[model samples]
Target: MQGLAQVPRLLLSYAGVQFEDYHYENPDHWFKEDKLHLGLDFPNLPYLVDGEYNITESGAIQRYIIDRWGPAELLGKDAKEKAKLESFLSIFTEIAGAAKGLFFNKEWETAKTAVIEKYRPKLEQLDKFVGENKFVLGYLTLADFVVAEDSHYIERLFPEDFKAFSFLGRIRAEFNDLPQIKKYYEQPKAFKGRFFPEYAAVTIEQ
Candidate 1:
């Protein structure tokens, strides 16, 4: 149930934003109930319900949460930095999009090579960009979270390919080691699995 929805929750936790997290073991509650009741303009899986702000779309929700609750630097220090972060985000989106064939379509046997090949150049760029830096943009920002989350999937699903991207593992490890993230994982309720539902064509425990 975590899946894509888990990303914002991780950002919320890291930002020290206290919010209720509901994991629907069944989809009925969302599709039949909440989707109809929640006043979101665009109803989606990871919608956020603040007292008056109802937002959907993972990228927008991440921006809202970080802008409202996280440190100012999380978004970026200036316009140029924000632009760079968005560029990294674009790469992440493409990499994740390519993974859909392997995970949801049950195409791993035939699609694995294509997926890994698709990631090679993008990952190399990221490794070079992140060379020895503690975080993207040289400090914690939304890009780090997005990249780390995607990297977690890659590392778990394609260990060999992931190993070649040295900085990715470092970023994920450093992110997980952050005080807030470490505390979140230490909580009894924290759960980890493939970033997809159990019914997915492929699953990897992360």
Candidate 2:
């Protein structure tokens, strides 16, 4: 299963860049030990250590990967496309945060309906934006990876509603078909089990 935090790794894998895939199984190990020792300005999960660069935050890590080891077009071709990419990224982040809130607040059972209703219109808008395009923004961009990973959470936790999202499904299929991604999936990796961390009250595996 691909976790939302694994988005940067997915981008690196797609670019065929070699990187260490580290997993912290125990929360205490991170919060009590490694988090304190790592020289990161904001110690956090999914931080990337590339030479002298130590970056935290998933979005920043993702952009770094794209800029450093890129199929440069992933950043978008022009200013307009870049702005659209950022818009999609912002929406994707909103969706991911909402999903995390369900478990973080321990309101999955109670808040599920409102969560679905709130995001359905947003997803519908995204669907129209994507329409028949091969990718979001009409080309492959980092937002595609972000949306693809976030969609899995919706599919698993809100399957009944997610079924209507043919555009999302199409983008996901296209993402999986990429040669680098196909190769990445074939290799053994540690990103498995629940989508959220163990502390979360609710979990989903896809």
Candidate 3:
């Protein structure tokens, strides 16, 4: 629901890894269906189902996949690095919480000021952390994927309004410009029934 699958898809593709992506419209009883299918008692998404195993949380899914299929080794070769990678992913799970509240929660519809207030500090901190890094870990890794996914979704939500968040704006540009990620975007294979909200008001900077 947070459009977070972008990171997993792009990471898997960039590393020449193969994975299945499932997409379908929200059923009439969305939460109810999720519980029966994925054991999702809470409303969340961008989950994965591998054969008989059903996984719902994004962090759990990412770590599980990385552990199963080794690539650039975003989880690190040592015990410490692996732990840090998981820690970074956890941080983003929190960061996206604010974005989700603003963009997805209907209860916060008229609370734009409150939403901005919540997001401003988070963005400032992220901007500082991502600075001067060619990619997370100084190479393409899960940490980069963590930030890339959100930047991608944010740009998609309001494609040209990222200037207010300059570092994030640059991150989004770099992500789309990456050759592998560009390829994934060109051939997303998005399921026909995927959600496509009507064009909202989007501002583009010249």
Candidate 4:
């Protein structure tokens, strides 16, 4: 599934790096058969095996790809800027955690209003943070890919909620319009894999 893997996938595509995009149809089977032999102390789904280096954790994988294949400007012009970018990226986990409650609620219709009310303020705050910038830091960076991918569930589940934040939509368009990224999305493989189908069903509803 794309899940956390999307961040690195998008970054790698944007960087024009040739890489394997493996998806697990049955994660339990894969874990039992393959994970134990991987030699990683902390084996996890969405892991990256590049050359002799095997990396786990989505964030670490994203940074490694960016450092190795992406432009230096993707990190930032200097240390302070990079730190600030990281701070913004860190907020994504909180946003995703909050949205997950809404996505997985068994009584979604009953819970939707309250969930939206609780998260709307935070979403507005993010809108302000994004402001008029083309990307999170006014340029394409790992932060853009990470934050955008994490927030994608929310955008699909609540289009009106995101429409209120015009900058968010613009950023999405900008990211999708990237030639390499555009090509990747056109592939059928991009849409394959299980990723919260119940949530997707809810999203597709009128």
Task: Check candidate 1 and list the clashing pairs.
Answer: none
Location of the lowest summed lDDT over 10 successive residues in candidate 4: 197-206
Cα-based lDDT for every prediction: 0.80, 0.79, 0.59, 0.73
Cα deviation at 95, candidate 1, in Å, is: 0.4
Q: Per-residue alpha-carbon lDDT of model 4 for 24-104, expressed as tens digits?
A: 677676778768887776888778998888999877888888898977778887898898887776665676666666666
Cα-based RMSD of the predictions, in order? 1.6, 2.0, 4.7, 2.8
Instruction: Rank candidates, lDDT, best first.
Output: 1, 2, 4, 3
* lDDT of candidate 2 over 1-206, digit per residue (tens): 24545778788888878888877777799999989998889988778999987999878888888899988889899888889888877876787678768766676877878987898888788778888998997778887787777777677667776778677778888888878777877887735456766687777755
Descending-TM-score candidate ranking:
1, 2, 4, 3
Among residues 3 or more apart in sequence or in different chains, the pairs in candidate 3 whose N, CA or C atoms overlap within 3 Å are none
Worst 10 residues of 1 by lDDT: 189-198
Task: Indicate whether candidate 1 or candidate 3 has the larger TM-score.
Answer: 1
Once fitted onto the true fold, the runs of candidate 4 whose alpha carbons sit more than 4 angstroms away are 186-194, 197-206
Query: What's the true lDDT of residue 98 in model 2?
Result: 85
Model 2 segments beyond 4 Å from truth?
A: none
The TM-score of candidate 2 is 0.90
